[model samples]
Target: MPSVTIHTTQNVSIDCETARIGTRIGAWLIDAVVLLVAYLVVLYTAEQFGSGFNREVALRLGPIFWAVLYFFVSEWLGSGRTVGKRLLHLRVIRLDGEELTPADHLTRALFLLPDVLFTAGTLALLFITTGGRSQRLGDIVARTVVIQDDPAADLSLADVLTIRNREQHRARYPAVQRLAEADMLTVQECLLRYRRYRNAAHREAVQLAGARLAGLLGIDPEEAAADAEQFLETLLLDYIVLTR
Candidate 1:
């Protein structure tokens, strides 16, 4: 799974994954079309009373109404669907892992004015955001992120199983997590060519791991290093118990 990361003000990376970009953008585009049509209707209504097409009214009301409706109902009822997302399957979530509330809706809606005021000015910033997230002025101010509606978003038994199988030896040892992420060679190479290690560096790693494991287990590190079968037996035992 790809990890989601958000950069802090100081540029520290945080681990998190929001919704998918495809779902969010697809939903937004569908909603934009609907909003545009609705804006024309509102303008047509104003014009029927002899007030003319009311360009100013349409310009102001279009984005405002869409923002308000989307922030409030879409986020609250269906979690940022806005009819389009409900059809296409998407969601908008907060950046801080909180539910979107009424206040969040109103605040983010109000913050959108600067983003849609003109074509090439401040509103142009909507195009430059990273990760395909077009937050606009409001999204930046609200610190909210729109994520996808992935059905399988949690850890499953299979994930745990894979980790267990790949790390059986380390389960009783408590060093699997670190070893899993190491910049070392693959397990295949270590197994097949371990006896032929002529390089000092290769020999060093095997010796160090054995020594470390022995010291941790209160055994003779030299003895563990001398007999590879004992180490393999212990590792296999760990795997068997973990699976059972």
Candidate 2:
């Protein structure tokens, strides 16, 4: 599939790069759960106190309470993170990557009225299915997009992790580090095009590419093949992110 990155018209800056839709959805679910908890807490607190608590205090104070909750708890403590976002490793921020102000928080929260009024989730569905950017009613109203907090995440890696690139790979794979760009290209290029090949094509190509890559890096072809591109890239990238 093709990917598009949203760029700012203001100063020639990229806003948000296209990331896997899954992580974005995952973050949204996390946020929804937090909102649910907040909703439940309000309801429960009212139950404990009185019918006055439920019907009067909560009904009257709910808006202000949640608004402030979003501002201070979600924004300040979580840095624009709701409960869902914290669990999913995601956060919301202004388009410019600045901390969202109280006004921004209030503005976004105000947009939730449509969802509440309908109670049918129409607004949310529209946002989830929206093209290019995952702009929900609130996000569009606020001019924001939902993205994976971990921009570097890739599906091929089972765990949340970070991988390095070519220059750094040399230091990590010092023996193969001496290999010229052409040699690296020879393997990577062939491997990169494996999808164009059929049947056992991916496997066969991987074996051959691994052999060549191994030769340059002075590693065993079998071992190199088993390592997979992800491991190699991880070794290249110095930083690793391990998530439970």
Candidate 3:
């Protein structure tokens, strides 16, 4: 699968796998099935209302409005996931390693008409397959990419065991709560990359992430500089202990 390495301002480089065409197709099909079922339900409910102006509006315009609303609201509230995306563990994220704004979602949603609906997905498929980053028209316009998440890769049995022990442990950094979920995910990715590669770049990623996080958490410079790796690990543990 194609992957992109996003370098954060903190200097942590995280590799994210692009969603495969097959997986994207599956998600689209699932979303289509959901829309079909919803349309059917709407049609059935409309029949109960009998022939009238309201019925005409409901039959003619309701589905269009609902479909638009569904995509917009789902991505916005679900943090870049629709029903299909959530089930498939695919999320839309900015290429710049920043959180996606509402404008980004709106741009993608607007472009979907030409990218998928009007062209019957031909344009999207073409761009995704031919483009280096597997981005469609909407993705290109919005500067976003669809990334696949591997839960097993992110958290191993050992990590889970450690988390279980953290339930009763006091947090070392209460300020870790100031960070968002995305920040913690980046920290986790940096740690994983360093563990797997153990090269200069990956090691720098860990060190940079640790220093950045320590600064963010208001940790003493001497303490954080003493052991960057340990500081990052402790922050991760503190996050789990405080949040979950």
Candidate 4:
């Protein structure tokens, strides 16, 4: 199976599986069921309170309006998680790893009209099955992707380091803030290997990576080689803070 690796603001590289088409359909069904239940309850209430409006019209239109409202509000407030997504351990996030804004959620919900409601989900199905990133039309437009939050294996000791000391890192190596996200991911992987393996090959690889990064940032080679782990950690922290 394919996976999408997201570099978090905390300097953690998480490999989240792209949700498959079948899994996305399952999530949609679960949400549909929830909407059905809500529709029944709301329709019942409206039948009693909506004196001037036609009950049949209310019954027909109320659910659609409520469903749209629910999806929009819930996705935004829940940080791209609906009840179905929460149940299935699925989440929507930006391809660049930033959190979704209210506009992003609204765009996604509004596009559901074309992607799911009108086309019977065929458009969404086609896009997700072929898109490779598990993107629907809305996701593509909103720069978002859905990921399955499955438990990860092969964690390294470097993964244990908390990258919250951004100020300290920036104070030490301000130039590291110029590193790109891809470059930061590379540094992260090397640090993880350095922490996980006690072998000479791993140490040498880390040393080489540290030297190259030091040159890129114009840091003194001797200083970077003296404490490669600390240099890499500080670089990762600077990248995370600046990018975030």
Q: Ranking under lDDT, best-scoring first?
A: 3, 4, 2, 1
TM-score of every candidate: 0.43, 0.46, 0.63, 0.65
Tens digit of lDDT per residue, candidate 4, span 1-244? Answer: 6677776556566555687677778888898899889888877776778677577777667766876778888888876778888788677877766567888988899888789888989999888888878799999999888877542313322232334554543456778777777887787777655564557998888788889989998989998899787777767666666555
How do the residues 153-213 of candidate 1 rate in per-residue lDDT, one tens digit apiece?
Answer: 2321112223324344355533322433121223223322343334667566556655665
Per lDDT, the best of the predicted structures is: 3
| RMSD of each candidate relative to the true structure | 13.1, 8.5, 9.2, 7.0
Task: Estimate candidate 2's RMSD in Å.
Answer: 8.5
Question: Against the true structure, whose TM-score is highest?
Answer: 4
- Each model's C-alpha lDDT? 0.50, 0.51, 0.76, 0.74
Error of 3 at 208 (Å): 19
With a 3 Å backbone cut-off (N, CA, C), the pairs that clash in candidate 1 are 4-16, 19-147, 19-148, 20-148, 74-80, 75-80
Worst 10 residues of 4 by lDDT: 151-160
- Rate residue 2 of model 1 by lDDT: 33
Q: By lDDT, is 1 or 2 better?
A: 2
What clash pairs does model 4 have? none
Each model's total of backbone clashes: 6, 5, 0, 0
Q: Candidate 2 — which residues are off by over 4 angstroms?
A: 1-15, 18-29, 36-73, 115-119, 151-244
